[model samples]
Target: MKKFTLSFLLIIVGFINAQAQDFQGMAVYESKTSTSDLKSRFEGNKDITPEMRKMIEDRMKGMFEKTFILNFDKITSTYKEEEKLDAPGQQQSQFGGGVKMMASMMGGGGTFYKNIKDKNYVVDKEFMGKEFLVKDSLPKLNWKMESETRQIGGYNCFKATAVRPVSKSDLRNIKFKNDKKDAAKTESKEKTTSIMEELEMPENITITAWYTPEIPVSQGPENYWGLPGLILEANDGKTTILCSKIVLNPKDKAVIKAPTNGKVISQKEYDETVVKKMEEIRKMNSGRNGNGMPMRMP
Candidate 1:
């Protein structure tokens, strides 16, 4: 009698919800992964059309998303690209290559994760053949973080914004000449020209993080969010994450927790370290294009 009553009430509630001015629909994320011929290593140096830049941006965005299903509680992520591309029976797509170009961009294959404490927190991304784990440099919230309210995945979310100062390491690797030098030095400094000093890493860098306080998890995609519920969007000034699909109240139970063990450091410390290291590497390879430039090896 109790179970029947509960079911009846739920059905009536569903009917009422159906009329609540909005239809309850799950978020659905769709993507079509394709491949093209592998161009020469200087592919980025040549002139870029708007279409090409969009393609690269799409692929970069795709790297942050996972196809795995998640409910209100327990969640898991799996990368289907490897199996789809690496399967022995798969047919070649471009120039007799059966592998996924995106996978190769990363190195071999990749994985994704969520912070146990913050279900919305996500680490950095890795790629196809590379084994080294890449993690998002933690946000130095010393600047500012402001928020707004919005609805996503059938829930209310608070959107926020922040300014992320470029770490010195990132600055060093940004490819700019130190100072004008002799002809002999100029050849080695082709990559580090001084023309880029005027550039600043864009501002407002919107991070549309969603939080409901109902879930209380601090994780989001790619070190982006840690609000109350879940974050469905996090855009730097240039890139963004928007939820296309969502699921709630699954039949299975979920166990939420936090993640540890990463390159934990103060934002300032990370900047100093990365900047110092980048400077060292750049100077060492200045005269050794033989090893500095990209090349295929057996």
Candidate 2:
């Protein structure tokens, strides 16, 4: 009878503990890529006309619809836990007109995760004379976070920010010229120079995340966290990412994995590879004669 009683008590305790745990929420990531902002024109001379630019956009869009695929099976997992305590009068007293008070998450208001992928950007990594094929991985770009605060759902939440900048490196390494886009015009030094200079990072992306200490989890979606309340918004300077619907803790389990389709190289290797590739492409431009063009995109 004692053994049975102990088992029943244990079961009750487990159930209570589970109920006291946080809500398993859905993690969503919103990022903005400047692929739509700028235009690349390739003319017979130093630049491409607007008409040429239009053709290029249409062509690339088709290619993206085909080869540039984004898969979400690579990165998607984080932990958010919130806690609370019952007031004696509210939770225990049968006739008391009181309510259980809640504690913050993170510290009282949030959750945090180590490395979560906001976007499933598969990279074809080639570094240090070795090339990695391609995989769904979180490509590390410029991500910055700041200590700011805001209010949501009547909760005074502390805020954190993250920023990511686009580098002109991709244009240098990857020749988007392909088979259709006149390779001759694409190889022009003046044209390449103009394109590269124009693609410089326009602004730093700022992501504001809120968290509370009630939950003691240092994890969030896409490797974002460290605030005093729930992160309701993550902005990349241009687009604002708001949590439309969130759950505290769910009954089912989550799964997360790193991508293996892209290459893996150290920071140094990436830099060198990009630099070398840029120089090669620049030198290969036969039209501009290495004179370089204006930094602004026409």
Candidate 3:
């Protein structure tokens, strides 16, 4: 009887080991961002009409709520946005032209593939129907461990924090177009500018992340990684991404692969391309406006 019990325990342990050896999992992340603080900063501006504010708010609301999937193995992972239906009567076309232009200028969705073993990554993006494959090294994050811990999705996670200094050029919402009409209408040049524009210099931002060691994998949604375990939640002041569901050793083997259908370019090259393309677009729009300067929503 004792021998039979020991044999059963050994079999169970072997099975668990085999499963760990071939571990493949998928994690679903729900992201939410609050624009209330940002909205409050510009809510009192007179140049921004209520209708315009509503449109901007709606666009920001959509930007904040998103769903993403992370398909991962022991060393590699691919993160992408899941296709979702728009809210009732809130289609993209319904937004104002300025909102649409801003969205385009901000760029669209992207697929990120990371390989911890290789210490590299690739991002797939589309611009004006042209596809681009951005290749670069994995982002290095210096994390400071904390004593705080929490439970996320049934897994006990530990807290880690980091501070990243970003330049003004890296921010998408910092630039405000110089509209001649706006310049003439208001007394203070700064007050007449787009309320959303950033007037101060760039500064460092704090990032907080929670990771679980049970997963024993260097993977997370988007570009977040680099802890002793899998990241279950991450907050970077403006946005928060949390893992809501996890499926371990899925029935169907997820083929973790990098994207290949695009013109391959280095990350720097892609940034330059986007800058040049946007400049051309600005020039064309200015010519059409007949003032050699495009008027943007304040």
Identify the leading candidate in terms of lDDT.
Answer: 3
Using lDDT, rank the candidates from best to worst: 3, 1, 2
The residue-by-residue lDDT of candidate 3 on 1-298, one tens digit each, is 9999999999999999887768999999987765555576565678988887777777876666678889998889999877767666666555544454444333234678999988899888765556778888876789999999999978999999998764232333343344557544533734233344323423677789999999999888877788989999998776688999999999997788898878898877776775565556555553453444543321
Which run of 10 residues does model 3 get worst, by summed lDDT? 167-176
Worst 10 residues of 1 by lDDT: 32-41
* Candidate 3 Cα RMSD (Å): 6.3
Candidate 1, superposed: residue stretches over 4 Å from native: 1-148, 163-206, 213-216, 252-285, 289-298
**Deviation in Å, model 3, residue 143 alpha carbon:** 1.8
Q: Rate the local accuracy (lDDT) of all candidates.
A: 0.41, 0.40, 0.73
lDDT of 1 by residue, 162-216 (tens): 5555434332112223344554565465566332232233322333445555444
Please write out the lDDT profile of model 2 over residues 1-298, one tens digit for every residue.
9999999999999997775442344544332333333333343334656765655555333222211111111123433322333334333433221111101100111222234425432233433234443323344434334456566544455666455543333331122333445445545634345443333333334455665444434444433444433455555444344443444554563543343443545434554555575455445553465564522111
Q: Give the winner by TM-score: 1 or 3.
A: 3
* TM-score of each model, in listed order: 0.44, 0.43, 0.73
- Give the Å error, residue 245, model 3: 1.4
